[model samples]
Target: MELIQVSHNEMAALFTRPSHIYNSVGFALLNAPKADSVEFLTFRDTRLRGGLILGMCGAMARSPFSAPFGGLLLTREQTAGAVEDMYLLAAQFAAGRGMALRVTLPPPFIGPGLYAKSVNVLQRLSGGCATVEINYHVDLRGVTDPVELYSRSAREKLRQARSHDCRFERLETTPEAIARVYDVIHRNRLHRGFPHNMALEQIVATSAVVPMDLFMLTVDGTPAAAAQVHRLNHEMAQVVYWGDLPEAQYARPMNLLPLEIYKYYLAHTPVRILDIGHSTDGGIINRGLCDYKESVGCRATPKPTFTVNLRREI
Candidate 1:
C-alpha cells in the first residue's frame, strides 16, 4: 500500500501483465509524457497485484494515452480490495501534490467481468466517468457459420466478389508484411478523407513489444486488402488497422476480408473476441462506420475515461 515512481526495469516487467498495448512501457516510450509529474506505479509483493500509469498536468493526473484508451491495469487474480487499495494509494499521492486523477479504461468487451469490477471500484473512488468512444468487437464463440453475422448488404457484397479470383491468407508478421499492410491502410484512409495516425516505424516498434498478425485478401495472388491485428490478450485480437487497395475496392475485398479475419482468429488462435476497434472519434459516433461494423456482426461497448478528485479532503 505504497506509491513510488516506477523504474525502467519495473516498466518493462509491467508490459508482460494482462493489459492494453497502449498502457505498456513500450507505448509510453514512444510518446513523451507531457505531465510535469508522471506516476508509473508497480504495485506488488512476492506476486504482482497490479500497475497504474498516471501523468499529472497541474491539478489533473491522467494516463499517458489521452486519445487512445488505456490506464489502470490489473491482473486476473486482483480482488476488489486490491484495486481499491491501488486507487487509494494513487489518490493519496495525487492529493498530496494537489492533483486529481484520470483514467481511460478499455471497453467492457475486452474483459467483461474484469471490466465491471474495475469500473465499479474506480467509480467508488473516482466518482464517475465520461464516455470517450464506442468500441466494437465480433464475438466468435459458439458460431458454426461465420457468414451468418454479416448484414444482407454485406452478404450481397460477398456474392459480388464470388466471380473474382480471391484468396485469404495469414501473412508472417515481418517488416515487409507490416509495410505492405500499412500501405493499403494509409491509402485507404487518404482516399476516404479519414485521418491516418500511424507511421510504418511506429507499427514496427510496437510489434516488437506485442504479438502482431498480418492478413491479406488477395485477388489473383495479388494483395487487394490487408489487416494488421494485435493480440490484446489470450482471449482477444484487435484489428488495429485494415483496408483494401483503392483499385481493388471494386472487387469487394472488404466483404471477403471480414469473413477471413473472423475465421482465421476462430481457428488459428485462442482468441474468442475479434475487436473491430472503435467506431467513434472523440465520442462522436460515425453512423456509417457503426453500420458497417454492425453489418459485419460487431457488438458495441462504451469505453470511457474516469476522473477522481484527489484534491478533496479524503
Candidate 2:
C-alpha cells in the first residue's frame, strides 16, 4: 500500500456522498486554513485490501493539563478488516509527527457492534501512542412514527410554538445567505471557546453539496437558526455545523431545525440514518446539549474519539 497527499479534486470525488463521519467539507475547510500542516494519508491497493483516509494536523498545541488535540477522519467502506489497515497508516503518521493525536470516531451506518469491534482493532495498533477522547452517536430509527419520536418535553415545546402560531421554513443557501449562516456558526464557536473552521467565504465555497434550503432555518419570516447537512452515503446524513442566536433561543429554532430537515431528508434524500454530531455522553461536557438532541428521538450510541501523548516518547 502507498500513502499520498490527497488534493481537493481527489477529496471532492471521495467525499461526494452523505457521511455520518469524516466530512469532506470539514477536511476542505481545515486544509484551506492550515494547508501546510494538515495532511491526508490515503491507502492504496494492498493485500489487507481496503482504503482509508486519515486527517492529520501537525505541530499543534499540546495541553499540559490534557492530551494534545489533533483530528481523525475515516471514510465508510464495506471491508470488514479496513479499520486495521487504517490504524496502521495512522500510527505511522502520528509517530512521525512527535505530537499527540486526537481521533474522533463517529458511529458508522453499519451499526454499533461492528463499530466497537473496529475500535478495539484500532486501539491495538495505535498502542501506547493513542487514547480515546470521546464517543458520540444516537439512534433515531427506533421511533416508527415521527410524532411519537419526540420526548415529552420536546412535544410540549412544539405545542407551545403551535399555540403561538409559529411556522418553520428550511431556507436554501444563496451567496448572501451562506454568510449569514456562517455568522451564526461564528457566534456558536466563539461562545464555546473554539475557533471558526474557515473564513466565511471559504465556507460558502465548500457548501456546494449542502442543500440550499436546509442551510438556513427561519421562524415567522425572521432568521433564527442555521445548519449545514451532508450526505454520508446513500443511507445516512450528517448534521455538520449548527448555530442559533440569543433572540432565536426563545423560539427554540435550534431544536426545530433538525426535525424539519430530518423530515425533509426522510421524504427526499435517500438517507435512512442521521448523525447529530457531538453529544455529552460522548464526553462533550454539555448535558443540556446532549439532552436537547435526545429530545428529538435521538438515543446515544457509542463511537470513540482517541488521543495520544507522543512528546514523552522521545
User: Model 2, clash count?
Assistant: 15
Q: Which model scores highest in TM-score? A: 1
Off by over 4 Å in 1: 11-16, 30-38, 43-48, 55-60, 64-67, 95-99, 124-129, 220-222, 312-314
TM-score: model 1 vs. ground truth: 0.85
lDDT per residue for candidate 2 within 124-155, as digits (tens), equals 64463443323233344544456577899898
Q: What does candidate 1's lDDT look like per residue over 1-314, in tens digits?
A: 55666775676776575556767666665554545655578776567677777766777777754436665676655777777787777777777788777777777876666677768877777666565678898998998789999999999999988779998888898898889889888988999889878779878877887789998888988889989888877887788888888999889998889898888887777888888888888789899999988998999987776777767685
Each prediction's total of clashing residue pairs, residues at least 3 apart in sequence or on different chains, is 0, 15
lDDT assessment of candidate 1 = 0.78
Q: Local distance difference test, per candidate?
A: 0.78, 0.55
